[model samples]
Target: MRSILPFALALLALPAASAQQQPYTPPKHTAPPPPGIARSTPEEVAQQADGGTQIERDRPATYALAEHRRLTRALGTLLPQRKGVVDAYVLSIALDSDPVFGREAREAGKVLARRYDAVGRTITLGGSDGKAPSPLPMGSPANLEAALARIAEVMDEQEDVLVLYTTSHGAPFGVVYNDGNEGFGAISPRRLAALLRAHRIERRLLIISACYSGVFVPPLSGPQSAVFSAAASDRSSFGCAAENDWTFFGDALVNRALRKPQPLEAAVTAAIAEIATWETRGKLKPSLPQQSIGVEVQAWLKPLEARMPKVATAPVGKPSVDSLQAP
Candidate 1:
């Protein structure tokens, strides 16, 4: 009976052992390779249409030469031989890629020059190509440096006040300097402060129109300077689209408020109010434009203010697409 039971258990164990010894094998079937296309390097790909490698263009040198000539001429015009109580030197720079900024900056410069009787003394730096009749040269950093040097050369460092109005796209880092075709870098607050200090431009009325332009106020402000920014450091301003004629800040501050025969402080206050209304109507965040007038700068600005040409105040209107139409 024991032998019979052992034999039955051994039969079951033998079947298990035989299954473990022989591993399962899958059927061999190869997959077809993916459809192949001709491989080519970037240069070769670019040349496929022409059947030859495209030659790199060397137009930068030519552009540089032309820009240099224009800069020299523009700088020559900004120099005033005789020094006045307030030789208002307007430097209107459009540092954005949008064409609207270029147009707005040029127009604002023209208006400021007329108001201050600084037609020849004004130096405008815009983003337009040299083919057009522009008041100033390109708005590049090098060109700005040269223009500042020219101002220093002509301006009385101690008495004269420099009215610099820069319109651009701004960031937390700094004000952007962009040419539509050729890319440029930003102008940091520190760098701008250094540029002004280097030129000994102590007495200044600096108006910055951009998003987060309040970042410029601290670095640029001093006892002899009046800094006005379009927006708070943490906020963004409105009406800076490519199609718009003027930024919300620019239109409110320059086109509407400053255009009136009023004090600079009063104009800024009025502009702020107008900007608030515009933002409310558009359902946008408030920019909260900033202004810092140093104690010494106020007295200096008074005499300059008196000399400004009295102009009729135009009715303030809401920004519209039709405003983009060329005059």
Candidate 2:
């Protein structure tokens, strides 16, 4: 009887051990729908929040038309009946909804327009003080698309170059497109590449001034493009707070380097050095501004450089690293 009892106990333990070795399978349950709300599928939720739908359905028509008209006028100013050697189009996007980005973007646009001889051709898109009619429109996906389309209408894709300088907060995903009280969404690297391709604008210079902007280079870089980013893919940029006049990169690149008589490539190189010094002084992790210049872009940019204005640059000064910390 004792032997039989021991064998029976071992047999019972075998089932328990097998159960312990088995993979976990969570129990599934179908709960009743809420008393009044209807159940929604994942697809339905996504469609409701789709970027295009959010703008069209949520944005008021009157405001939309007013913004559209403003952009049309701005673009009209730049459409030279005869295309120049390089018809530069500057799009300065302030995606963070902060006045600092807005101000910096506007100033950068002016600088690029002056340097590239694109005074009337440059389009500035962002919010501004209520005192004046806002330039272009608030930074949104729709506005960005419209601005690109307008440029395409006037620009000779084969001969002219597009210089797009965007400044704002960014993530690993891409540049952030926010309108403060309006709404916000990310412009993923893939999506931005698609937008540029859709326009069929081949020769391009893209400067992304934002945190983690290096993520844009891999996806957007091509033989006909020169991509510059404010930080490496894993790093954050500085001087993005609401009170500052410019981000660390924007100030160095646009306010300082590009304002001089130097070529775009030289300006980019100088900006890199300036950024490194600022980061070191702040005792912050290096942003490591990145530049990916395609072989073809150098040839494309030569004519534009020939036409660029030679301006006297003020002596470059060190940014107050303490005030330029990332917020």
Candidate 3:
């Protein structure tokens, strides 16, 4: 991410004639999203009946209208769904503007798209470098909702699956969205569950790479879903430095495990073990990644797994974690 201190200092050094330009757009929230959204249940969310309007919404940045237009065109480009096929619609997002999250999202999208034969059905959102002008639209809650709305309209609910991968910073409350200083918001467990239900997306594979992301597993997981979290509810995952390419959980799971031809269950098992090895060697507190797979998911999951490339791709980028001292 852009260094906050230097960003502020640069503003102070700007020429007086050009000082009117703001460094970044300020967020519209008067306060952070309400606490306790993590504790809400599906029934409670359904009763509200506002489709997540209670939470702080992600608004368009006035300065990034071109990026907003790109989002519109990106959604427009999604190929029409194929009939009688188990088409997977993939939505991979980097909610935070941190370069690490961006890189992880982009790579994860490629891996998933190839695995599921979703080349024309994938949408990736995030900047490769947090400071540069990105060709893709920056990730945000509103953008995600829009993508889902479109996918719901096109895909056959009975034959298709939604694969969502989100990588970002997090809190016990929810996944964090920090697009530099230009955008901010959170997607609580309640909020995400509500979105999926509203879109009628029943078959899903939800992989969340963020601190304390286990909070999502309880509300969103079911007989038709497979949910994987980077850490337990109270723990923080590692390897999210702005200069790095992948977070610890992401590198282990998407970059390494899932790239091989294996069942989802086996891939998750291997990733958890790999993450544990790294944490043990580094002498850091274990993040304790979590997974929940519905028994019913296997009927369709097996077919998709069978389609995976026979040859695994070699991993790219520096490893997310390493032994601090020589083993």
Candidate 4:
């Protein structure tokens, strides 16, 4: 699995310039999409006269977009529940220039972390404060670098990590970074994959919520890793929501999907389908949702499927490191 990680994880010496932080490139082939793609359909414009989903409307083109949004929420409530120590790093840098929605994303991370599992193990997440001074200046790159570094450090110091999630926006060709072309912004997929290998993280799982995130899978998806995204490489993701504030994909995963009782992949796939349908009904071109794994997560589950050991119950302040065991 390590041999197949992306370039970012391949060369992990730099604090911020790892392979994931590839140089910026303005996509020349693809032209800008129409502006209405960003417009809000709202109530009257919704496919349903009720201006909601799960309910039907008999209006013109407007009514078709009114979905109730009950889809992924059901799945979130059904995703398989687990217990483990998670070193979460939520980086929200909405200050970036390219219409970033980091602040809301950070909040989504917290929402997922709370119900993600509080007992049976400990979870240490950095960037919970919303803003962490990362290697990248203040964009997608910053979020990615902070996330990768946290994972590397945790693996080097701890063991048996369950998941790693990075949520942010991305340009067609790359993730946003610190400068218009510097440390901050989004990191590349290959570079991110390399970070996982360089840190020697085993059995890692990644969930990336971003627009055009499909571009990342080719380079970052791993044999031992499981990944989920908000939008395909060719489509623009919906964000800038009033409440979620980030992308709808992130909201579905953290707020809705995490609340479910299914396994990780099942929950994610359901969320992808729900979001795609919601967008399509709303007059927006449907974005493709994909689940591509180098190695099926299910393949590695059989050996450890029997039963996990209970976590040590030593007193909180007097915790004993020697008693630590994989749960």
Candidate 5:
């Protein structure tokens, strides 16, 4: 009987061991290899040295989720259009097919507009007609002005204005339109802010999704408004797909929205966290997003308060929405 008891315990240990050895899941990243950097994983190292690395692979951005959390705790929800003193906004999707930002830019406007009803909505021009090469089209020298005029009519009698923008790439000066010609395209943040100021439009916000977009914050930041840009000043972000769909920032933003609806500030924070967290499986970084400028953002600023998001305060200067940590 004693010998049988020992054997029975050994059998039980074997099942537990097998369960523990089921399988190991590894993390992944999709960053590009810098200059001449040549490094590979242990498994790949042997394959390259012995058999040479295989070429059957997709781009790095095609990676899967890295980590997931589980807890009994749970939570929830909610940009808009303004008119007149505060009218509806002009959601500008600059889809320049030649530069490859059509579908993606348009989608970005749609996403934010649908999610945040407190700001201007998006209005895309071109791309479906295979006009992908041009950046800003038809919006004109008076593009923003014209768009605002239409917004004024939309809001007709409302009292807050907002502008959400998306495009492929840009520099410090302004946004590129669908028009191949760079004829004074894209409304500068400084000018846009000044325009808002002119109206005495109590509340406003601008969401800029493009390369080198950190420029949005400094020019547009104020006590009564906020600006959120997708990338830093000198970095390239993902998403140059055929249809010109969303990039890493877009995907991340959508994912965050799915996890839990939040105020502009919260949603932006969570998305930044998602990309900044790194992994070996993929080489993508959470975009270094920017937020409100130097001034502290008050949660309750009265009527306009409801217009601009109750976002966290970003330090003044470049890249506004950065997370400020306490020492």
Candidate 6:
């Protein structure tokens, strides 16, 4: 499995303080600084004095219109929302190029879709195994925003639930997005909160698999939302090797626990226990995955849970923790 060393180093390099501050939306006339130059001054250092004039040069790639059209077509495939029914629209995305996340996204899409009766209303975004051409759109901040907008447009926001599963590397600031050197971006908790709020998507089940993902829980948690994170705000989850089919959290929750005909809460409990055992055996510090289910969300979640398949499926692939060599 991939070591957490590189991920930890990357987190140390990020300005985690940005997450606590208000985002700086560049003025309409201000253009993103040209590539190949970062910044001579610290971002946000002089925000109040300069009226937020500073800019971080490493802007995310603004992909061609063709990419937008591709996502549009994918959105079009979703079945129209059913009136008077509590439907679930599933969106599974892998924000990083690592094959493990991609594989997890693909399988997560299938599992969530089936479990939630969202077979024709599921969208999967990520590369595949790093071998075959990806049949889905690459996951990025822009694409994710576009997808959510599209789902909002087609679904009944009050009655439908948004099942969003994002797998990636993360820092205290946000979930990182990197796609084979062509894409780089991040989705912070505030940014995501704004997106959902803007779309009026009240009911949501968000499962984030990433290091330091617990940062999202506080901002996104609400009476109509359930947030489950792979790691605590200050911790890093393991099993991120590129060649593997699943990360530790993905395997524990999606591959094993959720595969059974249990309630979501029960599944989460089982996954947590399983992960703890694995971590202890490997002599590793606990990642301390977190979960929060809103009180109001249960009213709608029960109907969705009632539709789950009774038969259980066997887990596939090697256990993620098994890759950890003895300490």
Clashing pairs in 6: none
lDDT by residue for model 5 over 1-327, one digit each (tens)?
Answer: 357988888998998999877753211123333222135444433233222111212324422121001100100001233233333344555533332345454545555554444332445443332332332333332444445544544443235445556554555544533343222234455555555555554345566666667776776777656677777755544454333334555545542442244555666777666556521124554457778733433432233335443342221111211221112
Q: What is candidate 3's TM-score against the reference?
A: 0.81
lDDT of 6 by residue, 48-104 (tens): 212212122333566455566778788888899899889999999998777788889
Supply the TM-score for candidate 1.
Answer: 0.76
TM-score between model 2 and native? 0.77
The TM-score measured for candidate 5 stands at 0.52
Alpha-carbon local distance difference test for all models: 0.73, 0.74, 0.81, 0.43, 0.45, 0.81
- Cα lDDT of candidate 5 equals 0.45
The regions of model 5 sitting more than 4 angstroms off are: 1-90, 98-100, 118-122, 129-141, 153-158, 178-186, 241-243, 254-260, 277-287, 293-327
Instruction: Give the distance in Å from residue 229's predicted Cα in candidate 2 to where it truly belongs.
Output: 0.3
- What's the TM-score of every candidate structure? 0.76, 0.77, 0.81, 0.52, 0.52, 0.81
User: 2 or 6: which has the higher TM-score?
Assistant: 6
Ranking by TM-score: 6, 3, 2, 1, 5, 4
Ranking by lDDT: 6, 3, 2, 1, 5, 4
Which regions of candidate 4 deviate over 4 angstroms? 1-100, 115-147, 156-159, 178-184, 241-244, 294-296, 299-327
Residue 239 lDDT in model 5?
A: 52
Tell me the spans in candidate 2 whose CA falls farther than 4 Å from its real position. 1-62, 81-84, 129-135, 313-327
For model 1, the superposed segments whose C-alpha errors exceed 4 Å read: 1-59, 129-136, 313-327
Query: Residues 1-327, candidate 1, lDDT per residue (tens digit)?
Result: 356988888998998899878743321113221112025443333233122111112237677677778888888786573555677788888875475677678877877776666778898888642224344566766677777888888888887778888888887655766555344456767778888998889899899999989988999999999999999999998787776778888888888777778888888899999888878877778899988999898667777778777765563333532343436
- The alpha-carbon root-mean-square deviation between model 4 and the true structure, to one decimal in Å, is 21.9
Instruction: Supply every candidate's count of residue pairs whose N, Cα or C atoms clash at under 3 angstroms.
Output: 0, 1, 0, 56, 47, 0
Summarize candidate 4's per-residue lDDT along 47-105 as a digit string, tens digits. Answer: 22111111111225632232112211211232222334333222223323232244444
